[model samples]
Target: MLDTGCSVQGEQGDIPKEHPVLKSEKEVLEKVKLEQYQQIASARDLTDEEFSSLKEAHDTPPSERYAMGKYRLMAVYNICDTTVVTAQWVADYDNEHEKKVYRDLCVLSTSKMQDGLNYIHRMEQLSLSYSIENTFEARIPHKLDDSQYIKLKYAVDILAACGFSGPFSNDTVTAQTLNDNVNQYWELTKDKMQHTCTTLGLKMPMPKKWVFKCQLGFLNMVLHSVLGMKIGSVNTRRKMYHLKHHPKV
Candidate 1:
């Protein structure tokens, strides 16, 4: 009869092989099997000195929601969002838009190049280290320094105003193209947003207390007044005879 070691060994329970598990833990938790949990615990954790060094290496603040990765950068650029404005649209923006982008960029780019470079370097590290299924897989800028966090939020506000939506793929190629050209598009987005501000008679150079109101009700009234009258909807069509004869209400 073949001795199946099952009787005594199983009854006594198998001794687990030892391994070290750290407080920081490996980022790829899914790859670890359930059985490995017992083995890892059995292996014992590292010594205090070793653990201190490892913890220092991986210690992130409790508030940080997102892991550092390209997806974070993708969210920063609004590439992961459903809407991606085309490179063609970016290139062909009107002068007013261009001017606004230039203005915004001037403010953003004024930050020390050394700081910007440091942020970019960190991004590159995170991008290389992590691959996320979506932008929401990690929180952002929580892990970033103050300057980097400001830039991320500023970029989101500016890019959205210039017609780029948040991260997620409604159009992959357009998103990828924009992602590849983000640095360049920064200038373009700034310009486009500036132009929009100008069109709406917004104060320029963006003051500390600057504010914008869409006034949708007023816009809807205008549309209602003009609709079905054969007055072209284009805002800048100066040749419209009705506009010349219109009363100043």
Candidate 2:
């Protein structure tokens, strides 16, 4: 949770002059935002419908409720690796600037990145800790330098495009650059990197593949695999049957 002890009013006039580093960082952020806005403004303006769709996709307006609410149950997104937590806030701003203060509390293993309110944001006040299921590296977001932010963002992109082999494999990787963020992530996950690098290539017993031909249901579903695509009335209406013989499973 953020420390809310300081008076919001006086800090504006007093803090920046006293803390030059804070001033400098805020300036850098201003420059970055200006560049972003300029790029957006330079684009061929979108149709109002397109703009509305994009805005709706981008933002979820926050609520005014500040106090902790009841612990209602919600479904979670499951993944196989590191934990990720994202918190969003439209900063406590006057109505005019509130739209511009939309910031994110992006926490990861070694970094905390936010747009507004430099270092002393409110979330620190909670005194919380996170634990990954089996790993014991503390999983704390360490101080991320500017360069590592690039690395972490790349790591995130690789995650977003998980199970995509056409881009990562050596044969098709000409589309990727040497210092690309995905490549950086490929380098950072050392165990994964070693496995990909071939510490040992052991032959495994031949595996059986499952092939089923089916059609007929409220929803028409077709699963395509290396075997082939086939249509069958397997589970339709009153009939549901498996293959007459097994493939030596």
Candidate 3:
């Protein structure tokens, strides 16, 4: 979950002094109004027509769209991530200078690849604790200076193979990576884990696949609680069905 309420910790310590992208009060306000609409849609699951009607009605003479846009940008920066803002009062201005601010803000806000990488790390730790029986080790040879895009891609591939998705797979690395070697040590040998439940006399109580689903659901719940995003109910139902059909007696 994205920490929307986290504040910038100190005086913009490391941010470059002359970077661009800030907005005026008018643009900020416009953006805020739009975000409100987005929140309303999310909260109420409103239809397109309903939203359009609301927007049309709200549109007024001497429109404050510019101000609203600026407000929305600031709000997003203020809440989602604070590494973007350079000046404190960029959102207050209404002149051409405000355009520069808006431009800079857009660039900074969207360039959060590092943030995504950090999320991958968190997901990896959570997955290992939930699924693997052994402790996690740092075997994957990740570059300390690798681009965020590469890190994100690597994490996604690892997770998909492990039968999970989203941030859950953030720690997954290529099979040839050193991390894979470490993971192998922690993973229960499949034959051993399945032997008693599958080979025998005892009816397996729950299938391994189902167990994974339950884990995924639990993970999803954690993410929703933390990030404010909703996973679809269909996915939950599918997981439950898998568990029921593949139970270990």
- Give the winner by TM-score: 3
List ranges where model 2 is wrong by over 4 Å: 1-18, 52-249
For model 3, residues 1-249, the per-residue Cα lDDT tens digits are 898986676555544455342335557788886554443223322244654555576563323443343345554444343233323233333234343333332432353534554555665556556544555464332433322233234323333334333432133233233234324422533334233223222233343563433433433332232222223323433321111111110
Please provide, for model 1 over 132-231, each residue's C-alpha lDDT reduced to its tens digit, 9 standing for 90 to 100. 4344445443443322333334334433332333221021223233333444444445455554334434344544432221222222222222210111
Q: How would you order the candidates by lDDT, starting with the best?
A: 3, 1, 2
Which 10-residue span in candidate 2 carries the lowest summed lDDT? 66-75
Candidate 2 lDDT, tens digit per residue, 81-149?
211211111111212222111111123312422221223233322212332333546433332221223
Q: List where candidate 3 sits over 4 angstroms from the true fold.
A: 1-115, 118-217, 230-249
TM-score, cand. 3 = 0.20
Show the lowest summed lDDT stretch of 10 residues, model 3: 240-249
Per-prediction TM-score to the true structure, in the order listed: 0.15, 0.17, 0.20
Top candidate when judged by lDDT against the true structure: 3
The TM-score obtained by model 1 is: 0.15
Global Cα RMSD, each model:
25.2, 25.1, 21.5
Q: How well does candidate 3 score on lDDT at residue 58?
A: 55
Task: Report, for every candidate in turn, its global Cα lDDT versus the true structure.
Answer: 0.34, 0.27, 0.37
Q: Deviation in angstroms for 50 in model 3?
A: 34
Q: Between 2 and 3, whose TM-score is larger?
A: 3
